[model samples]
Target chain A: MNDDVTIATAQQLIEFLGTFAFAISGIRHAAAKHFDWFGGYVCGIAVAIGGGTIRDVMLGATPFWMTNPIYIICTALALCMVILCSKRMERLQNAWFVFDTLGLALFTIAGIQKSLDYGQPFWVAIIMGCITGSAGGVIRDILLNNEPVILRKEIYAMASVAGGFVYWGLSELDVAIQLTALLSFVITCAIRFLAVRYHVSLPQLKTDDEINRVDNG
Target chain B: MNDDVTIATAQQLIEFLGTFAFAISGIRHAAAKHFDWFGGYVCGIAVAIGGGTIRDVMLGATPFWMTNPIYIICTALALCMVILCSKRMERLQNAWFVFDTLGLALFTIAGIQKSLDYGQPFWVAIIMGCITGSAGGVIRDILLNNEPVILRKEIYAMASVAGGFVYWGLSELDVAIQLTALLSFVITCAIRFLAVRYHVSLPQLKTDDEINRVDNG
Candidate 1:
C-alpha cells in the first residue's frame, strides 16, 4: 500500500510538471508571434492538454482537463511567466529544452498506461503514446499558422514511439509497472536529447513535381 | 412511423452527400499541393469526418466513423471522382459551393441535435454545432500548411452559430424537431450564401506590434 501510494504520488507530480512545461512551451511560441494575452493563454492551454484530451476522447473517456481546473491555472501561470520574464526565458533555451523533453516523456507514459487501462491493444496504446506526446505541438503549430514541425522535421514523435515499444517489451518480460514507466521515460528523454544534439531528422517527402508525375502515371 | 423513417433516410442521405463534398474539397486542395494519391486520400478522410469525430469525442461517445466504414468508402469514391474529373470539377465551382453549403448546414444541425441528445446545455450545443460545421476545413488547412481561412477570411462558423440559435429558439417555441432541423439548415445556408455573395467577413486580429504593446502595458 505504501509503495502504491508512492508510485501514484510520483505519477501525479510528473503530470503536473509536464503540464506546466508544455504550457510554458506554448506560451513562449505565442509570445514570439506577439499574440494577445488571451490568445497566448489559449495556446498554452491547448499545448498543455490538447494531446491528452485527444487521447481521452479517442479512448471514450472524459477529457482530463474538463474535470480539473488545474491545467487552466497552470497555463495562466505559464503565460504570466512569459510576460514577466520574457528576456530571461529567451536566455534559458537549454532549460526550455529539458522541460519540453520531460513533458514529452511523461505524457507518452501516461498515454500508454491509460490506453492499457482502457483495454486497448499494445499497437493502439503505442500510437496513443505518440499522439499524446506530439499532437499538442501539432495543434499549437496549427494555431500559430506554421507547418507542423513533426511532419516536416525532427525525430520527436519517433522518440515517443520508441518509448512505447520499450514499455511493451518490458511489460512482456514481466517487469513491474513502475519500473517500466521509469525506464520508458528515460529512454524517451534520451532519444530526444540525442536526436536534437546530433541534429538527426527524417527525410522529407517527395517534391511536388515528383509526386505529381507518379500520380499521373 | 412512415414520417420517422423518411426523416431518418433524409438525414442519412444528407450525411452521405456532405461527406462526399467535403472529401472532394480536401482532395482537390491536396492535388493542388501535388501530394501523392495516398496523401490526398488522407486529407479527404480528414475533412470528411474530422468535425464529427471531434464532436463525438468531446461528447464522450465513440467516434462515428469507427462503427461505419461507409465514410471511408465515400472518401475513396470522392478521390476517384477528383482523379477522373479534375478539370470539370474545377469548373463546377458553383456546384461545389452549393454542396459545401449544404454540408455546412446539415452538419451544424446534426451537431446541435447530437449535443442536446447527450444532455449538453443549449450554449454548449451551439458551440459544438459551429465546430462541426467548420472544424474539418480548419484541420484540412492545417494539414495543407495554410493559415486557416475561417480565422482570416470568412463568416463560415458564425453562420453555424446563428443556425444553432435558431434551433434553440424554435425548439423552445415547441416547434416539431424535423421542422426545427430544416429551418436551422436553411438559415445556416442562407447566411453563408449571402455572406459570400456580399463579400462579408470578420476583421483580422490585432497586428503583432499592437498586441505586443498591449501585452507589455
Candidate 2:
C-alpha cells in the first residue's frame, strides 16, 4: 500500500550484488542445459526473484521486483556475463562457488530478517530462509527436467535453516541488530563452505535400491 | 477481502469436480514417478489449486484456496481415491484422460470469468485462461522431472485461449453469463478432443531444439 519504498545506498548495493550472484548461477545452469539467451535470461530472473516473490505472495504484498526495474537489469547483465565467459567461467571454480555461496548467505539473512519484520514466528522465518536460499535452484532444476537438489539430500537449505536459528538465538540473548545479522550471515557462509569442502551431505530418506524398486514396480 | 466466499450450490459442485480431477491427475503422475505418499499428496494439492493461486497472485488477490478449507479436503479425497486404486488406475486411460480434460475445460472458463470480472483486457483474459488450464500440469511435470508438455507442443493451452475468445465474443453480443460460460466450456472441450484425436501438436521453437542440441553436444 505504500507509494514508495526507499532504502539506504549500502543496502541497495548489497541487494544488487546478491541478485547478480544468484542470476549468474541461474544463467550458467540454463546455458549448461543448452537454453537460448532468452531462456537463460528468464531462468536467471526467476532464480534471482523466485523466492522473494513467493514470500511476497504469502505476505499478501505486491512483489518487490514488480516496482523495481533493477532486478530485471541485473538479470540481463548476468546473461551477458555468462555469454561472454561461457568457456572461461566453465573452467573457474572458486569464483562461481563463492558467488553462489554469497548469494545463499545474503538471501538467507534477507529472508529471516524480512519474516521477523512481518511479525512471523521463528519457525516461519526458518522456512523462509530455506526457501530463499534454495527455491531458485529448485525452479531451475525443474525447467531443466532434473530432480531438485534441495528435495534430495543437499545441505544448502539446511545452512539457511541453521542461520535462522542463529538469528533467533542472538535475539533471545539481546544481541544488537547489526551484529546479530552479521553473525547469522557468517554462520551461513561458514556452514556452506564446510559442507562443500568436507563433502558433507544429509542422508537420504530411503536407500537408492529401495527407491529404484518402487520406481520399477 | 470479503468476509465469506460463499458460492451457489451448482458452482460449488463444479469447482469440487474440477479440483477432484486435477488432483487425481497430479497424484497419478506422482505415483508413476515413484514419489512417496507425502510427495504425491503435495503434488495432488498443488495441481488441484496451483493455477488459481498463480492467477490470484497476478491479480493481487489473496489466494482463494488459502481462505477456503474445502479445497484441501477435496484433494485429500482425491488422494484416497488414488491410493485405493493405485494399481488399476495406472492402466486405466479413460478415467485419467476424462478427468484431466474435464478439469482443463472447467478451469479455462473459471480463469476467463475471473479475469473479465477483474476488468482485464481480452488478451489478458485469454492468457489467464491458458494459465489456469495448463499451469498446474506444467507444475506437475516439473515436480516429476519432465519438460512441461504444454511448453513443447500441446494445443491443450491453445484450446483455453480459444475459449477465452469465444467468451469475449459472446459477451459482446449480449449473451447471458450462464450461456456464454457454457458455450465457452463446450468449445474448449471440443477443441481439446479434436486435437488429441487428430494427433495435433504445435512445433517446438528453435530455442528448444538448439538447446537440446547443445545439451547433447
TM-score of each: 0.60, 0.59
lDDT values of the candidates?
0.86, 0.78
Segments in model 1 whose C-alpha atoms lie over 4 Å from true places: A1-45, A58-60, A65-138, A145-217, B1-6, B210-217
Query: For model 1, how does the per-residue alpha-carbon lDDT over A92-166 read when each residue is reduced to its tens digit?
Result: 778878888989999999899999999999999999999999999999888889777888898999999999999
- Model 1: clashing residue pairs? none
- Cα shift from native, residue A37, model 1 (Å): 13
**Where is model 2 more than 4 Å wrong at Cα?**
A1-49, A57-130, A143-145, A152-217, B1-7, B35-42, B76-84, B143-145, B151-153, B197-217
**Which stretch of 10 consecutive residues in model 2 chain A shows the poorest summed lDDT?**
A1-10
Q: In order, what fnat does every candidate score? A: 0.18, 0.16
RMSD (Å) per prediction: 7.8, 8.5
- For lDDT, the strongest prediction is 1
